[model samples]
Target: MKKMYLSVVFLLCGAVLHGQQTPSGKVFRAGAATSNITPKIGTSNNGGMQDITIRSIHDETLARGIVLDDGQTRLAIVVSDLCMISREVLDEAKRRASEVTKIPAANMMMSATHTHSGGTACPVFQSEPDKDYGKFLSARIADAVIRANHNLAPARIGWGVGSEPTQVFNRRWKMKPGTPIINPFGKEDRVKMNPGIGNPNLLEPAGPVDPGLPVVSVQTPAGRPIALLANYSLHYVGGNGPGEVSADYYGMFANRMQQMLGAEGQDPAFVTVMSNGTSGNINNIDFGGKAPDAVLPYEKMRAVANVVAAEAFKVYQNIKYQDWISLSSAQKEISLGVRKPAADELVRAKDIISKAKKPIMTSMEEVYAQETMAMKDYPDQVPLILQAFRIGDLAITAIPCEVFVEIGLDIKQRSPFKPTFSISLANGYNGYLPTPEHHKLGGYETWRAKSSYLEVDASTKITASLFELLDKLEAANH
Candidate 1:
């Protein structure tokens, strides 16, 4: 009886030891030539389109599979610098990666920075492409996956949040009493006299700004930082011109972080990746229209990018490293139906199309037109992905779409996990996921814009699904 009891003790000890083992992670910089790509005209800035070259560029975050105490699943995260990752492309990438690495398709979460100035717009959405830009991007992104798999190493992880108020501003300005503005139809209109003018009235004076800059620092057991992933929601619009193909503020921010950390020798084979949060209605420019005397320029964008990066470095210094952890990830697809164009709206669209002047427009304009037509035809069928991965105290909720700030706040408010980072524009960019109320306002985001194809209710439904997934993951963890 004594011998049997000793053997049982040994077995239990081994199980505990196995459960506490740290999972490995890897970081790799998949550099590609993305310069010479022009900004999609008519969407944002049309400043005399120049041939812009990429400076500091976008990156991919590839975390290896980590099995948590549950011992039944694994998780991976990939961050890229593109306008948005489409479902088709994401599905293909996952399928390919799984074939190569045996990492299940559902176990991985991929997101883009939503940088307007990056390579050609994704072909899945944009009907036309600038030369071979799409092909180049697809190949380069795949390379990132392969490289990350090669660089896997045993590392400790730490997470923390910090804030920088001056770097980002709420672009949606509330119209003050007596403020004058032109209507979308070119008629002069008086600014509403109500307090709701210019403000995002539904929540409060302003929506919850994720000043909580979530940072994940990976380091070797020797305490050297190897890579850092930081997430924020402010839209990337530092440099706005046709010729410039930069990573906007994201690139500059990453470079600044590297420089700051390098000074302390804390920078590990470092790559600072800026994952964009839900920023569908966010922009740096608050165009009060009259071409104000002082406009924020591209150079100002670079400066702000550096400032944001500096703020991230401040948070990085405070992270406490931990090694004993397990990892598990789950992803589910929720179906989102498209908004059909109203009967009267279809007639109006037909009239507008008949009167449109340009016979030859750029690919960007064509995409915009196509999305509008899609709204009039079949309701778009889109897949909403809710993916979650837990690494000790750090849990990442990957949501699809350009999520609004409110949604992210809502997730954080109810999340059972501490430091649960919500990443938007992940796996696929179906379009702007606006709250149900925003849909009623009938603004650009809520409308059938060229880039987005879904209705406003889609955002709310998707957010609810995400929260559900988080709740389940948290329960499983316990």
Candidate 2:
């Protein structure tokens, strides 16, 4: 009888210790709203034309850190409200943050919101000069990291995927036999036939659309929601008419979420961060068929933001927290072939340059022009960085540019983990990475120009590299 009692006691103690060994997470919110950067109004046909001004909005970074009781490993998810995150800059930030927090560099996953209306834009291609916007951006980003690290406390995390179809539309249009191609911006006077319409049978409707909106919520030990991170691929097009830099629709969406779950509302202590997914060819506006009579107003943009926020909250309400925690990460370098201008293509480019209407010259235009001239003298190769992180059941794969929906879906379909999300414009901006099909279609996204200098094969090679990283992560975990 004594031996049996001792054995039972030992079994109970083992169960209790195992249960207590689960890792805990914490949520931190930091924001810097002032970006001295202002848009160069009226520079292009797409430049600001309406009287929209940003008085005040939320431009935030949310960082979530997960640490095991043993402290052997730490993982963090840092989301920023910006157009892009350069690998060099992000590496420096990671080095600094890791030095301070002791978190491994590979364990840090940093991503951007891809907000076009945000602070000074980074260089998209080698043809574009690197903007000095980092002077103001670096300090703000570092402050966010410090604040997030300071707010670490015990928490529980839950994740779910919600669908919102009406909010996103395919911006690229396919050419069909006898199908009229309308102007993208809806000005009937601007309607013109697609210049490359000879091979009509080969062209198809724009790329695939990803309407999945994944929400990840972290709550305090006491059950108060501390932070919510939502991922989607739609490009931020709500602030076409802008002023001083702002976070565009991403800010609006966060505001709506705060109001819905804040103290005065549902009273959840929720801090929301909107992360951009593979949205190279995705937008809120449908560029196909007939164009609208007028541009989408700010009010319409706000409405769209609210709808997305509401759908995200719906997913948040249905989450179930898990206790199993495991972390893994991998990074790889990929080479994308250079798209050198052929002799004939150079002649054609010169012809277009001679006839194309030039906009008013500003300091910004002069800088861009100088960069364009320099690019003509050289051929450049784009380096793609693929990074992946696993936090329990949630897996994050980071790609360096605006990726097409098909590529995003392909990654998700092949991922060994559930609820996988691809964060785009993360760690770098190498322009749009369209699939082979979209590359053949030859639209604004796939066109190789001064601003978009990457070759079409770059997208394919990067996609393959990311999949290989995913496989390695799965193998390590098992």
Candidate 3:
């Protein structure tokens, strides 16, 4: 019949040029949200000790977000299970998600999966940040970036790198020299952190382990997978026993990666995030081969969240999706020099706080060396805030502290970008930064309390201000 109507009009014009939706060349937009932010159960569980007991939540500490807009640069990356979130709750959650997604609070990129049982989610040690749980964690991190900026669409981006490295090791060790410990700054350290695993004068692990995990996958141009951002290096696994309050192992790695990617019977929200790299010295013990009935405590947080949710579903089944690329974000503010305690170490910290008789100080390395000689001349500088993002060739770096895994593998071996990872405790809190040869190997992250008091060349000036703001966000959208 007329050559079958010209072969059905050439197969309907090749299905209208392959249904024209997304082949990815750049229009890039994405969205994601999550809220929860746990807390409530005698709060205050900043990694134990305030008499280690009252802390019972068990799971539900979130505030995840993802909102990228490449209609010419827009980025909002938040992830907070907690146990650190200060620069006043990450600049009041990027100024209330930049007052309802007007975006730009320095292109907002907050982080904190440093989950050592993240419960009373922030107001850290000596109080003053918990005015109604910091406005309910800055209104649920700006309601998860204004519900991921009202759900932007047309997405596709993927990046992957895996290596569980036998359940992340390197918790500090290195003993044998007349094996006599003391550490938590009671002094006598030759390196120690979980030093008891098969103690026989240990002699190893003084740092090294990037058992990688880098993942970044956001789909849905009809592929359906709204989010997945991962970056590991261990440093959170807690046993969930005594006083519970756990999100440890990052709430079993975003609820077993939303039941392995397909988000199962759906909607507990599908956006799994787990950033916390530079492991501040890595964790999830192996200590001389930890086994007594293998994996316990929330079953080793569901076996390390099912080996990082099966490597983010093998990096979202090897992403070949890309709708657009070329997005950028950069923010900086560096200034170190808060390493006080001189003047004969503040006269031996007021002669050990005049024999610490009470203010409840039975040792936290003598009340953080009397809180580093009572904040010697008060906050004389430590202001940090470094961020850089440029998805599509993926490189995200943001450091606030607890950093270490060899400065996140030396900024991913001098990042000129190539799946470069690094998201350590983002926004603020500069406790341990180590490395000046691990502060001459003193251990407990180079004691001097007030939480590993910075400035031992604060890791070469925050690794040269995050490689000069990652070469100015790689010479931005040009």
Candidate 4:
């Protein structure tokens, strides 16, 4: 009887020591991992009106993820280096990851970094995705989550906010009256996108910029950094060499964060993720300001990365890491009307394409003409996935579109959680999400194309759904 009792006690101790629990009654753990997602040379790259064939690689792209388990609940957040990812691809990734880690498919939040030079993963304008590359990307994203789950250990988590206002500028401008602002559809517009730098015709920016840089840091019990996920509202800094594949500034920011935090040479390498925020109408250029001097191929992006990373490092110094934090996720699919072209517009599109001289579309009119025909076959309504995750007092919302800065600002202002930030281009890629007011202003982002075909009220509906999820999360926490 004495021997049997001793054996039972030993078994119980072993169970607790083998990652089932920490010394404390509740175990809050986190793990982070990265999966290389760099596409092969000669693969298609998106982010321009025309597709680019990759000729050289400037840097490796990655899908960096972090898994957090708070005794009862588990949540995974992943950020990938790509222009945009489709719903089907992300859904498959979530399914594969769930099968391995037993984390509910809804509990994982995955988003693209919106790097213009990264591998093409979704069709935008004339750029089409490479089907094989999409499949490979899905598998790698799932692998990232599985690996992170396997590495879970007792960890600390905290969040802080930083601001770098100098880098972000609203790219849409209200041109002087009678300035020829013809859109692809040959309609006049009040605002123009990327209107020349220091052009006297420029009046002012049509929208405001969001300069918030929110950082979420995870670390081991011994204070070794596990991962740091940062969100910024600046669109990609695009100065890469022609036909060169890169993760753009997103990957650069990750590397800089790792170096600045002194997280080099650890047993498990430190992973840093820079997720795109609401930057659909934001860019690094100042349209109304003086044009910057000519820069080397990757110089501009590196400069932007350093500046943003420096701001993040400042916020990192003041983070208050907590040993235990509640984690919860809620997901919902909402259907919104698609702004398909009307009968007259479709006819005009077909006419334009039929009369085009070049075999491939080279003019703006030809590109948008092709887009109009594609939109004609789209369903009247399409479902979109909206997700919200709660990490202690911090809230992170994910939307499957290139969101506008105003929407993000409104969410932060109204969210029940303090210092809330959103990840755009998440789970799927729809198109640019401009507000109804902006839509009325008739800018490039509002033109009817696959790249901007969301209904006028899509932003309103999305925010309503997100608030519902966020409110539920907050109530449950209290």
Candidate 5:
């Protein structure tokens, strides 16, 4: 009897150390909220080669977030409306939230929506971030998490993936032989980005498009919706008026989803988040088709949002909501080399800038010359945060770059979870992540600019690290 008692005691202690709470009485809970992060007029906006000042506010930008607690472990997922946010800004936001909620910073995964008209938070090309706006943005992001945590209630969660093939197309195309495709670096490019519609010289697309729309929905035990988080690989659909600040299609999708699900006017207000997926090489333009009819400002984005939200609503109805499931998150920081300019490249860049007609670049050649000079001042290496989350049988991986669709597809194929999807521009911004083969083809995405300055092998390293993290989560959950 004494020996049996000792064995039982040891087993109970081990269970406690592993954080296995008693299953019979535990409950799964969730909460979601949004915090507006829209900038005032005259604030700097990103997503263009040159800096832009916001002349108007067409729509409000937001930092939408969800918090999930599986009776033991907690996880937070946030999507912000901005072109790109640096690692420094996200880290600060995480720290602030962690202080309030007691959740480790690593357990939170945050990403940007890649909205072209949102407030600037990272310097890309010539658009510099407004330092005050960055500070305000961080606080607002943290507030989103804090408010969501405060609203936690008993909930059920489910996930499913649907397809919207008609909306996504590979934007990079291979031109016919000897096509005059000149890059900003005075070199010939085999592929052209957004090659004009109906161009006979276009041979074929250079990459593949991912049409998967993965969604995770949470609701009260009695069936009232709490939040819906959806991921799609198509880049932002931009049709906002010039100098107008908007969340692009992301915000539109959120609003459309609320209406479709009849989630409006709820006590806590339903939150819907449309996160950008792996779309560095994907877009909505149909290059092989006829010229599209020009639409008024915000019209194109609204139409696209309706299509995506309709698909999401169709998928949302069929998901099998689980009353209780496990949640786990794993994060890692990896260092990558920066693709700095070569000695000869710097000399050429200086010469090009000296001969420019004006200080403000008017041509691609001049703009890239300045980018080359700026690359000289960057550090030899930088760190990126990679994260993965497991909710029941579904898996979500987060990469800090504008990840290519091929990489996302490869991860989905190899992941231990069945319905795995990737969220791009997550945790931080690290520029465009192209495959090594794409780098060799030398398209605009692989140009030697701040927007694409990671070493050629950065994607390989990031994917490998993510697999390790996913494996860790799988083992722990099992």
Candidate 6:
């Protein structure tokens, strides 16, 4: 069945940057490294609202860093096998990396792959970030960047995109009017997430999917692969069964692709980093919940990794090396307000909260009830990190929330660069940022949890801010 699927190159941008010269004669240099980031025993898993356990390692989670330099300017990006990395930890990791490599804090972009099976990061609205694990992950990330900085050699990179519509999809669905479920606001909503299909009440999905798999590959002058980083807008393909700490398909995809595309040399050959794209409402599971044959947990992950990696190899073959390229990076802090419930609704929230003797969130609505009350303690406003990086005609945008595919697609469409993409779960975790229309429809994505707290128009504001930065980067090139 998988053989029947064919993927097309979404977009391919090939250009040169001749801004600076290096001793090696190549204008740009690249290097990559990976640091094992699997959590220690007893660390809490971060996939769900509950505190799930990590009994063992299905596979070692990793923090993969890639550094690119044009002699005069340098920037780094790190992809962690985490569910969601907290703002505090992300900032600290960037700070430490800067101290060693001298890459400005704003020039570093870090993001978790949103692997549900991975261990806890600096969580919001609760206990402090896991002190030991947080430090370990941050230190490892910084070290990886430093190592990549050390190993930097004259290199070349190319960009392209591929499609896997069957493997990646939107999980939001519109339900029948009569079937009403309680939303975070404690009111009925027309749309819901994962609305099972057997119920015949299912309508079309609430949103469209962006199955664009954009890849950026770095290689030595001789064309030996050094690192390949890809961004796909689908959320994780569920974790390794239960009780296992795996990097989910994101890691598996990278590992498998490394073998398929990697050239022989080092023990691991080259690093393969698969970064999660905007997928707040996307996943591999059959959310409509009606499939003739159900795929086993690990099997589904392997299938996704195989198909995606196969497509990436195809993109890899098309990229030709460049001797010189320009690099630029910038960051900004966007102020956003946490969404609040109405005054009278808060009374109802209190009533709902009073029923529970302890904090045990069962249903989705109950999860919001607890989170809504917790926001009373959160500052009225929060700072979100928005960043952009330019590699010739390719532009990268970093947003700190579980951004929906619509916003990502909008950025790509409106981008001045030929090939552009945005990454979510970078720099901070603020939950889901649905488009304005989805907020009005009211679904699980718009629900108030540790994940989705920003104001209704946050999607609009953040999108605008990101575009503004991209404009600056493109203008500077001129």
Best by TM-score: 4
State each candidate's clash count: 12, 0, 3, 0, 0, 5
Error of 1 at 478 (Å): 1.4
lDDT of 2 by residue, 347-449 (tens): 5445544554553223332323433443567456667678987767678898878788888888888888888989887766676777776666556665454
The residue-by-residue lDDT of candidate 5 on 1-478, one tens digit each, is: 9999999888765553333454344578888999999998998887688788899999999999999998778899999999989988999999999999988899999999999999989888878888999899899999999999888888889989999998899999999998898888888888999999999899999989999999999999889999999999988889889999999999999999999888888879899999999999999899998898989999989999999999999899899999889888898989999999999999999999999986677688899999999999999999988999999889999999999999999999999998999999999998999999999888889997878999998989999999999999989977
Q: Could you tell which candidate, 1 or 5, scores higher by TM-score?
A: 5
lDDT of 4 by residue, 1-478 (tens): 9999999878766654354763446768888999999998988988688878899898898999999999889999999999889999999999999999999999999999988988988888877888999899999999999999988887889989999999999999998888888888988889999888879999999999999999999988788899999999988998999989888899889889888888877768898989999999999998877888999998999999999999999999999999888889888999999998889998888999998986679889999999999998899999999999999989999999989999999999999999899999999988999999999999888888887898999999999999999999988998
**lDDT scores in order:** 0.58, 0.61, 0.75, 0.91, 0.91, 0.80
Off by over 4 Å in 2: 1-70, 124-132, 178-204, 263-269, 287-297, 347-374, 377-379
**Candidate 3 lDDT score relative to the true structure:** 0.75
The TM-score values for the models, in the order shown, are 0.76, 0.76, 0.34, 0.96, 0.95, 0.91
For 1-478, candidate 1 gives per-residue lDDT tens digits of: 9999999778765544343332332221111111122334322211112223333332321222121122334445666666665666667767776677566878777777776666543443333344344444444454445445444444566788888755454544445445454433223433221233234432222233556688877665566556677888786764455344556677667667767877334322455678887666665543322232444546766777777777787888888877646566767888878776667656655555555564532443343444455566554675577787776667788877777777887777778788777888887767677687655544445546535567657767776777777777778779
Off by over 4 Å in 5: 1-24
Model 4 segments more than 4 A misplaced: 1-17
**138 Cα displacement, candidate 6 (Å):** 1.6
Error of 1 at 219 (Å): 0.5
Error of 4 at 421 (Å): 0.4
lDDT tens digits, residues 92-201, model 6? 88888899889998889999998888878966433335788888888887887888777777687887888778776677888777777776565888787877657587
Candidate 3 lDDT by residue in tens digits, 206-261 = 87889888888887667777888888878788777777767777767777777776
Candidate 3's displacement at residue 304, Å, is: 27
| Between candidates 1 and 2, the lDDT winner | 2
